[model samples]
Target: MSDSGRRMRTVLHADMDAFFVSVELRRRPELAGQPVVVGGTGNRGVVAAASYEARRFGVHSALPSTVARRRCPHAVFLPGDHTLYSEVSRQVREIFERYTPLVEPLSLDEAFLDVTGARRLFGDGRAIAAQIRAAIADELDLGCSVGVAPNKFLAKLASVEAKPRAHRDRIDPGEGVTVIQPGSEQEFLDPLPVQRLWGVGPATLDKLQRLGVVTVADLRRLDLSVLSTSLGANQARHLAALAVGADDRDVEPDREAKSIGHEETYAQDKHSPAEIRRELIRLIDAVTQRMRKQGVGARTWTLKVRFAGFVTITRSVTTQNTVDESQEIIDLLTPVLAGIDPSPGVRLLGVSGSNLGTPVAQLTFDDVADERPDWHAATDALDEIRDKFGSDAIGRGSSIVGGRIRTIKRGGQQWGPDQPPSREISHEDDATR
Candidate 1:
């Protein structure tokens, strides 16, 4: 296959470079060359994104902020501005649409675009990738790395290979864009670690290690029957196919989310019931707000509680009616939270909504007599306030009283390692889900 046109299916995976930190640098040019971390600076805060300079000190996303500070004491930590990130992501998506409509967003920072249909108009895969990257750089002042390949699996892996790497003494500026031509897929994948294959999680890695399969070549050498016996037949077939670079998955555009949820790991465990309830209320509000934005409601709500020692438990309730209101969710979960034992001190709290569909109103007899304010109208008003002024422009009275309900405040500054986070930090364990 030549680079002139798409004789084979072409996919391009574009990932923003150190996305959150890069956006911050675009706004604050003074922080360009410095080690910067974008996340909550509190003891319990987790790193969302770290600049290449900061990563050299062994700091990266999802690592505890406390550990990140201990490693990179001089690093500048800033609370992230998610609203700004979302807006920039929308702009990036618009640019992708200009090239092709088959754009699948994996996150705010990355997406996969199937451009086979666009080759005639846009030259070819590599040319289209280059144009997209250039447009993003020129329009958004953001840096991105893209990978062009025959399939989504290889395209995503190539994007990772194209991203810059941080070393102890220096950073390696990788190829901004990489192309994996037809008939070169095996050559491109053979020497990589077996762990690089998608869906090879910790358990699968351990299984593969036991089989002495450390690289793609080793996985390829294993007989189908052996693999089928070791890892269940279905997964065995999946890995076997991937080992040979035979991914046929299409790039799905605007994929509907399976679930919506938010979680927070606290600096200190909450022993008081009132504190736990308040946090629960806050989480429900956040989750429902997102659901409303998506025009979906949840029939099931799951409450995740992590104890001090990392022992986690979840309680779920399915309602007859799909709910998009925070107060309704709060009422359903309050008893569930009350039933859980907090004597061990809860270290983390999470709420997730699932079994989603369009919300249907059921006029209950109790609801007719209950003269409560319209929660939907109230939330709409709150959303409008947030859209205009900012997320912190308004809040629930209970959430505002003690300031304990707010996590890390968005866009706040961190002067030093030990400073407390000024506001609530909302961490989504699985945004795509």
Candidate 2:
């Protein structure tokens, strides 16, 4: 192991098991041990969560619901209610915050907690983990798996191993939460597959495999320069550090989102420029609506396009000031799209905003003579309706050009939902087949 790999700090990875399906099962105990899949409920829907029972039949998240149905004929499938799921996630986070303020949420279901200082106030790592698990179970009625180790890498792996055994009544599972001491993080991670490391996706792993670097240990043995030549300097250095379990990034309290983006893959590749423009407008409207709901405006606009051949390219522009104007954003991206080679059929389209700032408020003055009195009155009325009913209560005609919009509400938080289904499927076959 490298010299840096030997140094370590206490880190904990805590994750809720089968979070979405588990949350659903909690309310309906009769569904226990049954197969459940949660996501969109339509012919074109995709799976968001699959119960362990459903997974046994090859059902998994992101898989088409049509295929999932073929695997688990009896599985209960439900359209994911983001609002309900978010409420449960909020309660779960509140439980974690009680234990440690230094919580870094990876997603709605998982988080990393820096309990290094909590040892003195609470107890040892294992004891603190037990307390956290108990608090979640007792207060939120949720099940969670926790791994306590000397650093983030090992802690994450330990959590994965401990997930299936978290229901154990005793202090130890069969292998116990594989605890790697201060100097053992690298040794524990070395034998794992190269693909297991963060950022080592399929493309990168394919490149590493061709070079005969199959394991983390093998990656560590390679010259940094050789790796850099293939993977670029930044990625190579990051991977080298990860190979030996030497991540120095600390658990942050408030990990602000650097960007907010959304993308959709069409059922078939689109070749028409007019069709693409229409889709772009829809995406821009959707994105801007979300920005408004979040009380944020962004200065950076990014466009991502994936061709039929799977080659992807991204173009971006940083503006002088934060903007949430849909038309302005679409205008800025028009030329960027025009510059791209349009011969390749586009399969996916995405829009993202970054360099966010506080939300902009429209100013109104009674003394203004040129302003449209009726337009200003209508705007104020719409804002009032949004504040009371919801953001989706009122929208401009241009906003809903080709699609219906839904409002997503989770606890006190509200935002625009993902695109709605063209048609709904029956809820009778909602459970796993």
Number of the top-ranking candidate, with lDDT as the measure: 1
**Per-residue alpha-carbon lDDT of candidate 1 for residues 332-358, written as tens digits (9 for 90 to 100):** 998999999888999888899999999
| Weakest ten-residue segment in model 2 by summed lDDT | 424-433
Off by over 4 Å in 2: 1-8, 165-178, 210-212, 221-236, 263-286, 303-318, 325-350, 359-380, 398-433
Give candidate 1's root-mean-square deviation (CA, Å): 5.5
Residue 19 in model 1: lDDT? 91
Reference-based lDDT, residue 372, model 2: 36
Kindly list the per-residue Cα lDDT of model 2 for residues 289-398, writing each as its tens digit: 67776778788999999888979999999877787766567778988877877567887788889999984545447436556344334544655687798767666443
Clashes of 2: 11
Give all candidates' CA lDDT scores: 0.85, 0.73
Inter-residue clash pairs, candidate 1: 259-433, 406-424, 407-423, 407-424, 407-425, 408-423, 408-424, 408-425, 409-423
